[model samples]
Target: MSFLDKAKDFIDKHDEQVDQALEKVGAEVDKRTGHKYTTHIDKGVDEAQKRTGEGDTRP
Candidate 1:
């Protein structure tokens, strides 16, 4: 499979870990920016989490 496919499979298997990592990264970005972009960062994180395991095309 291609790199994107491999990434999708990995995310499908470890969605929770991916979500946690995204949250941690978002929080760090917010902290570094003095919370100025808190709302935007949170929205981005939410969007990313929503698409975590959606790549599964299995029956």
Candidate 2:
């Protein structure tokens, strides 16, 4: 399988963990950027989680 396919398989098998990790990564990016891109980061994280089959955790 190609790298993208392997990554997709891994994400599907560990969706919950992937979701949590994405949240953490987004939060870190927001912090590092001094919250200047909080909205963008959150949207990106939500989209990533959705694509990984975790659904949208955002309210």
Candidate whose TM-score is highest: 1
Cα lDDT tens digits for candidate 2, 1-59:
99999988888888888888899999999999999999999889988889885565544
Highest-lDDT candidate: 2
lDDT for model 2 comes to: 0.86
Give lDDT per model, in order: 0.84, 0.86
Pairs of residues clashing in candidate 2: none
Off by over 4 Å in 1: 54-59
**Candidate 1 per-residue C-alpha lDDT over 1-59 given as tens digits, one digit per residue, 9 for 90 to 100:** 99999999999998778888888999999999999999999999888888887532212
User: Ten-residue segment with the worst summed lDDT in candidate 1?
Assistant: 50-59
Candidate 2 — worst ten consecutive residues by lDDT sum? 50-59
> In candidate 2, which residue ranges exceed 4 Å CA deviation?
57-59
Candidate 2 has what TM-score? 0.81
Residue 52 error for model 2, in Å? Answer: 0.8
How many steric overlaps are in each model, in order? 0, 0
